[model samples]
Target: MDHAHIITELGHANITRRMLATHYAVDSEDEQLVRHIRRLLNRGDLENWKQRVHALWVTERSGVLNDAILGDVVHDEAMEVRTHAMHLLAERKDWNKTQQNWVLLALHDDHPNVQRAAANALSLHPNENHIRPLIQVRETTPDNDPQWLYGMRLALRNQLRDEDSWHSLMGYDFSEIDAERIADVAMAIPSESAGDFLVWMASKHEVKEDSLLQFFRHAARYASREQLNNLAHLVPRKFPNKSELQLELFQSVRQGLLERGEGMSPSILNWGSQMVRQIMQKNITSGETWSYHTIDGVKNTPNPWFLQVRSSADGDRDSTFICSLPAGGESYTGILRSPIFKCPEQMSFHLAGHDGYPDNPRQKKNGLRLVDSISGQVLQEAYAPRNDTAQPYTWNLLEFTGRNVFLEIIDADEGAAYAWLALGRLKPEVIPFPELSPNEEGKRLVSAAQLAGELRLNQYIPNLKEWIVGPVPDASVSIAAAKALSRLDEANLPARLSDLLQHSGKLGTAITALRKAMIAETHTTQRALLSEMVGMLPLRYQQEVMNLLSNHATSTGWLVTQIKEGRLSPLTLRNQVAYSKMESVVSGDVKILLKEWKDSLPAPNHLLQDLIERRSEGFDFQNANLTNGRALFELACSQCHQIAGEGALIGPQLDGVASRGVARLIEDILAPSRNMDPAFQVYLITMADGEVISGMPRREQGNAFVLADASGQELTVNLSNIRTRNLVSQSLMPDNFDELFDDQQFTDLVGFLLHDSSH
Candidate 1:
């Protein structure tokens, strides 16, 4: 109704406040009324009242308030009030002592919002006097804090043009500063001294690697031609193993020097350009090219033990040396010789073994050997058991000087075995050699064990078993090796898992292996063994193990008991029960207990449906915590939908979503499948192998189409492999969010989505 009446009702309703502010802007010229409004704005207790005051100030261009009153408002307890006060101060043609002091005070404010406002205000009046205070504040503040970062940038921007400012900036200990921010400021400053300081920082060995990399990148963009040449020379020594960094640095240097009509040294140029080309091509150096040969008078048969050059069986197109032996072939021999080179301290080659035939107890034996061609002595040997998958093996030839070595594949058994070998000299810096460090040997062994599992070579089972039970102190390696062993041979897995469980130190690993086995094991006998083993575990492990086993009919009663006892979380129980395919085992007391538990929890479906039907008609927006809602949105929705450029671009951005109205937003969240954008529709691509993958189509790149899955993982499927593409009627966004979160959580989430602009 009347302006005074609306002003009186500001505390009662948000709409009243808006109407009052609008009326004050257009019609009110009364000084008493302006003072009254200013007093109301100064009252920081009212939520967002300062924003309404700011709206009135903007609409009512005439300044009814003096400097003192505005200065007092700048110190208001609310951040928005202080921010708006700073904005008003920035509009002043010349700030007085009081306003400058207030601006400086706001700069040191703990809130990033006030600090950003202060920074913007200071930018309007860029004075050298502000630099010292900014630097002091930055030095005392934590490096990770955004305030310190913004303060540093603001300080640098104000003083960057002055050559002497570089000295002041460089004098401070930058170790406490974020390297990325330092680089950003350095890049912004156009002074040559700033460039020199960055180059100096880059050259320092004591600098952190992250800082060094950042400094190097910026220096490349800003440094002089002489500095670039110097940096080019140091690149090979400083970052020899970092091919990516080398490529970046080289490109930067080449571009920078070319613009200045200067060039780097021939050797540096050649090395850098060659490395860039090599990295772009993804090429690996196969040392001293090896040639394959069969033993003389061994009767080279095409059916078994024949040497052939072929593409790597692992899908890598690199040429590999393959030695094949057919089933029922016995006593076959072959040798692969490397050209003589000044042999290093050690040389290694990748070897993978696969049995062409399936698992059979009657299959014959197969073995591979490495020998020195000069001495005709076996350096290393391996033998595979029957029914083994392709297994990867590694061979290291040690202490061979100027002598060629031979790789021998011998399939002496009646079963077929194939060996794939690829020789490449590994840089010790890039690839860890087990012999180099005892501490790292465990990690290397773990990698080797995993590779063996990937190749499905059952031949390494005994070695892996020894590693698991051996004196190797690293439990992680032991666990990994045990997992590899389980993958190779499932028959003895229960016994191995039981042995692993005996070591309390490896309980975590044992539990992991046990869980995997339980999920994969289909045999009733194996499941029984798993049950027995799980029973033997300690009580603490039993809860989690039983949770995994909850899908089994035998374990449902145990799960219900745990749930009733408060030992199991409701969320975990709900997830397990919902997804479980176990035959109905709940009866009598157990069924009653489950029903009681369900009744005690908030029913998601009913709550969601009611909220959707009611819309915002009966919703209590004032009580909802927007902060908690933002957290929930980040946890659940941020992966796909972005709001204000803060999340992934997999889905539509929710910026200005308030314009869509609460009802529409609710409907969108509750029923995402309705009236969905055709572009956001999920596509189910069936591969030639019958595997189905569903995701929102991102783009078509070359022969592969990229798609973003619900989990935010991007998948690149080859067009050739896709047998059919079907557009799904449903949205990629999961529909169970309503079921997943409680009513308060759902309200908070929607509140956050509505206030997207505020965030």
Candidate 2:
């Protein structure tokens, strides 16, 4: 609106038109219109208190507020007019002492908003008079009232210049009054000067220990990046001999910076390196020194109580233990994380309670995880056995000595019975690896392959050379073993490997291992790779595979008879027409054997129901071939399961099957998932590279998950490199029992489980 029309509206007899004119004049952004409205208010034409307040607003909005008019409105009997006047006064630096006293007196005003406005105004020109009323308002206002304190802070900002100023401003001599109260008031202020006062107070050894955490919290929220960096470097320099004070100050600053998203500062991290080595002995003073998290409704989360400091000999050499079992019966699952620190040469800890269950999948859920804080990968991990004692564990951190890392103590089991892992203090100390004889070199694939090449044990040459030709679970493992053999005796490796491949028994043994590894594999690509490895061995006339077929001894007895009588040259029996295929070839003694194998277990449900109903009935072991039963166990179960130390140890062991009775054994064969244990449940893992694997679950490294299929073949995959991880309800054991054995073979398998007492 034009100035003439706006002035007409302001002079209108109607109060509504006058108010509307005031609103338009304020927002019109026209300085001339605002001055004209100001003139109307000065002349008392706008008589309503609201109109006077709004006219004042229009003056300020258009950068034409008359200080004399605003000064007059400060006590206009209308709180809104006075409040707006006080706010405008607060922003002025040129207000005189009388004007300052006007604001200071408003600080004692009954209404909080007006008092705050006055307090804010007085902050710009605070004097001895402003301090008293500012403190009075602060004292009366709620402690949680942020605005009061913030306003009060401005009035107290000059007081935070140094230690003496703060003590004097607090009106108490440091020694005569409560040191605690001094700290209380000092820590509440947020600014670099306040930080300076805090540091200076620490220098005088006057900072109360009780208020230190709050001080740290205050600094974390408001301290500048430069101030925090100074707290790390300059504080230590000033207090060179006060290491304890230095550490506390450094850690406090370091933690504050982290919480503020000031990513880790190297100097700050270095200042705490020596202290991170003392978690067991030192107490955490910050709100959350460790990152505590939970799954499945875990309770009694990490606090001072969760981080328990024990007597040196309490748990057979303890200092501190991160206790997950807060109330002693919670089957809670949680991960306790330590602050990030550089890894020392070595770190050792102990587990004083159940870290895992024996031979159970829950065993995989509880353990300590040493994580790479930089890359977020798990370098290594360790697990305590299923015993309630202090089980010492030491991780070799030489590989990551200089890298920043944090440790996680995980207890993820929901079983109430002994369901916690009390992780002892992690101290940087060495624990050397125990010596293992070279005689152990070829006994296990993993240990052998890793140690043999490095140690160069010549005795492993025989086993390594045999594995080189083919039939190994992974072609890479075979290659590694071959390389290991070369390291042992490069001169004789090729000949030994060639000779081992040409032998039927050894070649068959290697091929058998490869096939079993294939059985444990769920991925077709991996299975196909194993199959191609099988072709590394040339088939014989009576292929070595003939002896390895699933329990054919009973049906093929006559073939041996025919061969012995010269009626059949079994070695040259090409008329039977053996042919090579990627899939396992199990030729029976007659055509019916192949037909029976083709229809193996078409409907597994019918067989499982029948076996469950009959229990152990109709089993005539008197006619059952005990010798053939052992052969059947080797053929079918050995690949994925173990019995009497003869078969692959990849899957669940079958040592206690005989005690389960005949009916249960029959049901187990037909219904693999009927009553499967969680330890044997399948986990499907998709890797970051898009490869997928299914296997039984095992302990997880912070950055990796270990998976072992029913065949007991295990693989540790990087957790950070995983795209997806899912728990499959089905057991890892395949559901094709009937396909692997016929009536006699099945009967013999049942006999092995039912009557073989030693198994």
Candidate 3:
């Protein structure tokens, strides 16, 4: 490697100096090589430097490379070079007595950077010689500084190969620091004394709280009961005395025993047994009941008895024993303990307890609430007040719809010690309605009720069965009945009850409902009601109903029958031709007979229908045909572009596009703008040096300075090192919309695109 080039790339600092020192020692050559190496050392750049200096050390200066770099590396003004040099010398084989001594001297260096380097160097050949010194450093150093402790432990870790190093290191004082360090030391101290070191550390009060807890958590991973019992005396004094904690410890130990029990011998059994017993003994003594009044109230029930948790620091770690019941028989043994913490102020706390159970008796008037136990963000509130009768109480079972459920039973009285608060997952209850009968009158009435919103036609046509039966006899006898049925269909019936009876016949009421659904002017909320009502109709009737409306002409013969049957009250045979014209526009089907049918129509025909037919027949003449192309182009294509600022960049600005010519423009639209601008070309390249780079071409001299991929990130590249560069061809526009527009709309859109906004 070009050492000068590498050094220049990285910044010149003390770190680089030490690295150079180590490299020189490793690349032990003649005086000529040394002078050349010294030149690189003179310049000061080591910013983006990386990789091991092994090439210089192992190949060039292998013979002369001892730990000579240690002296300058430790005291180097640049912290980075000192760190690198120390690490370099650590693996060098000439780590003799003198070199070891030098490494130890560097351990006491004031800067943690220096100490870290020395520690790493010493750990390279970890043995018994370094343990005592490491322990000495650890004992005198402040444990709060992680670097110091980390380095000490690192140096000692590899040296702890046997019992001697392990036992020797365990005798030092590590009490004042933290649990993490204690655990680190214990882990290093032969696996045999892992339990012993933890127990001893636990016995000392000087260990920090989090550290001690962390040590137990670590020990729990490997140590068993007998090993744990060896440390039991240390645990009870440190941990808060709670039944839950005791239970958790017991369960963890039990699990550990089961997992590793086969390897355990009888000698370890006694410690395990004793630890379990002691923990269980503490649990038994921790429970105690005390009394307190609900509040200073008129009905002061002083029967409240709560378990006073004696071992915890917070006074609120108390549980009130509401009630208990037998698990298997009439004799009750199960204890019902609820967490009832005393807030700093006079405020009521919610409790979770059941009213009563067949086997487990419930505690009356229970309430429970889960608040930010730490910061007090009240999550849920639940209570069941005394319910003497089944009157609907103001209970918000589910709050905020689905987020949480609040089971509240309000007494509405001045004071209540609302008890229960058990938090679990919430499940919603869905109630299913009963099915309707098939009587025509009943079905129509039900349909009318169902369709009473916007689709009031639902009231008239209950289902396919009634629809097949045809309109009721004497349907339009009175306008009052006609309008009453209409109002019911549209959900707009008057307040009077007798008014609903006027529109009683099946078909008359059904037609009234359908009229309300199709033509009634009503509220928007009611409009959705019509769509929903339409959905309730039998699926088979939907097609028939639409067919009746669509066949406005006598084409289906149904319209003629409706007129003869007096059902076509809205239009007469002579005027129905107007609807036939709409049919021609909507459906472009023209036959020989249909052509003759159109010739007999009224002279002043609708303008739009005539245009639809004319546009349909222009395919025979030429590839291009137009009548009012400019008007068509304006209507279809002005939204997305501007040749000179009138269109949107939803596509590219096209002012200079006329230069590309119509043929290329046509190809661009047919294809798309996928080709990258030469200035904007992006490349994916991996260098021989193993650096991966990709970016847009910012500057392309001999070496390209890619601004970076627009979608990716920026990175520089020497053109020579790049392995890959290619342009991709494919427009990003969707290509499957050929059939979306009519021939005119398509033609119009294309014309507007070609004709500049300047035109």
Candidate 4:
């Protein structure tokens, strides 16, 4: 194991494992060996010397190497050798001030990778004196250089005790910094001024959309109620047409207010009203009404109900008529008369009631009713059984066909009762309305059913069931309804799902519906029946069914058993399907089976290298067919990426990906994590309940973060329940396109990505 023998062995075409072990054992403690390795590293004849240096660094004992030698290697011609030397120096715990200065110097390295390694080393053993130099480096670095962003993050984290650092970081012009980094700094800094600066930037500065979104996301997690409310005021005015930004602002502000137990400001309330109006496609001004009148039995001082601003469903508060009747007032009545117009397709409003004086027991008898303006017939009535808490209600006036109507608030109780009414609007059309044509209605119903499932609104179970079993059943609508019903009441879902499978005209849609229902079904007998039914389908259809069911724990176990027992073909678990199965099952015999299947595939980089070489030699880009490329992309790539708004948005959108050049595109396809962005890094979060989730961070809401997983499903995990979160270094994008497609097919895909062609 002499140094000469080690150097010769390292230069071998493929060094044997025993030689590596021997080199690791002797190189660190042997001073003579270290000296010899250093001499070889300085020589020009030692080919693959960088590898030798890497092996030497890995084998060298911490604090054993001389400072002068380590410092010299820190400036080596090879970046990898420099990085390895810096890494070795950083491992020493006994580094004095002079040696620590070397780490600081490495932070300003010309190469981004070297700079990142130095930054990581600095984070391991940070010193207060290093903060100023790091800040200086960040200030001088060019914005376009990727290293600049890394420098900025390092500076922000190591800000130390300097109050001025916050201002200096925040004052960087938009060109010098991005919104995401600014927000990250604000979140890390425990100062009110930092949060205020973000709000001010959002309101006064012309921030780009992506950066502004990051700011809003961080604000939701860290900003105060008043600060978020202030930001909300600027949103409607500043980004009137940006629905995503508006939604984020509104949700953040509303959550902030709700958490603080406060009400929304007037400006936020107005913005919410406008959002509702826009969603309903109604003219904002057309719904305005001021004909509220009280009946003759009220006291002279004030009517029982009057127009006021109060908390409503549309945010923390909305403009609505408030009704408050005092005890022993005999009886009081309030009415809001509508302006005459043609009968609307839908009329809806929010209603909330509470005891004005909770101390009095006599306020429990109050009731509110909606009545026809001319006939005085009660359309809907809500009674307050308990007067201590606010009871909210929604009134969908689909049955009310008249042009004019009245909202009647009555109080006959001996104690005071109060109610807030808002979001009252009459729209000409609403989604999933009964009057829509069959296809449009079906699509709308599918969307509504999905929303209901997300919210876990069990009350919608009956409605969803009706959609599934209705006389004119649309396969899409029935499938969506079945899925929603399965979520709401899993125990009672198999029958309805079975009915759809037997009667539906579209076999694929029906099987999908049945598959979803089976995934959620807990009864073993029902699951067995469902599995048997799926087993009878074609192998392709069965594989698709397995893909949908693989995410469920119990269903995955069943499928694995089926595969093992020869009830299902092993070919079903191949390629992307195998990857999906491996990702879903965390632990068990199923995990072992899926992992074995995964390990049997060809090495990813080997396949990638072969493809790259083939393309480099002679791949015809001029004659590549865009249509075929699109077809291949939709089959292999669309599951994660979006192309012309037609695919799942689990990965980055490829709208202008062609402009990024074919070489860059090929590199990405071959080695996705080679230079992966931090934002796109997937997080592996283990919950306190033992459930493991992996996805990219979508947004922060209150104490939870929403993550969108590989299948485009969003999972919201509470911060408190997270046992551990590890940032995965690799990209979520799976590799091995060479195995998935032939040379011509892969070329066509590259052509599709490099041109502006649509399906």
Best by TM-score: 4
TM-score, candidate 4, is: 0.37
The digit string of per-residue lDDT tens for model 1 on 1-759 reads: 354554555434465666566556446565555566656555543455545455436333556666655755766667766777777777777777877889889878867777777777876776656666665555555667776467557654765557665555545565534333445576677556666667765665355655566566556556765766677667777777765556555555544443333445665455554553343232111332233333332323222333333343345444333344323433333443333333345543434444334444423234555567667786667554231223334545465544555444444332224422222223232222222222233344455555455446665555565555443423445566766665576443343343243244335555554544433434455554465455445543453343334433445654555455555545443332222322234467666666666667677557757768775565567767898887687667878988988768898878888788778888788778765888788886667754456689997744557899765757666777788887867677766555656778878888888877555
Rank candidates, lDDT, best first.
4, 1, 2, 3
Better of 1 and 4 by lDDT: 4
Q: Write model 2 residue lDDT over 488-516, tens digit each, in one string.
A: 55332122122133233345665444533
| Residues 1-759, model 3: lDDT tens digits | 555554342333455664664565454444544444443333322223332232223322544332334344345566555566667667676566776786787778667777888888887777777877776676666678787667778777767645566566545654445443546666544354565556566665555554555455445445555556554545555554432343344334433333333322343333234333342232111212111112211221112222211111123334322221112211211112222232221123223333434254444334434343345455554554233111112224233233321222211112222222221111221111112111122222222222222122332322212221222211111222334343344232211111222223323444344434434345344343334433433322322232223322322333333333444322222222223322432333433334444455454234423433444343222333333333343222333334555433433466666466544544454334334244333343445543333333445532334444322223345566655554423222322223235665555544544454325
The parts of candidate 4 lying over 4 Å away from their true place are 1-434, 437-480, 489-522, 533-552, 567-618, 628-667, 670-679, 688-690, 711-715, 734-745, 756-759
Q: Order the candidates by TM-score, highest first — what do you get? A: 4, 1, 3, 2
lDDT of all predictions, in order shown?
Answer: 0.55, 0.55, 0.39, 0.57
- Candidate 3's displacement at residue 23, Å, is 9.1
After superposing candidate 1 on the true structure, give the runs of residues whose Cα lies further than 4 Å from its correct spot: 1-3, 9-32, 35-60, 90-97, 110-112, 123-125, 139-181, 188-193, 203-205, 225-251, 259-759
lDDT by residue (530-602, candidate 4, tens digit) is 6566656655545555555554465566667777766666656643533454465557765776778656656
The TM-score, computed over Cα atoms with residue i paired to residue i, of candidate 3 is 0.33
Model 2 regions lying over 4 Å from their true place: 1-20, 23-47, 58-72, 123-133, 144-146, 154-193, 200-210, 214-250, 253-759
**What lDDT is reached at residue 737 by model 4?**
52
Number of clashing pairs per prediction, in order: 6, 8, 51, 0
Better of 3 and 4 by TM-score: 4
Per-candidate TM equals 0.37, 0.32, 0.33, 0.37
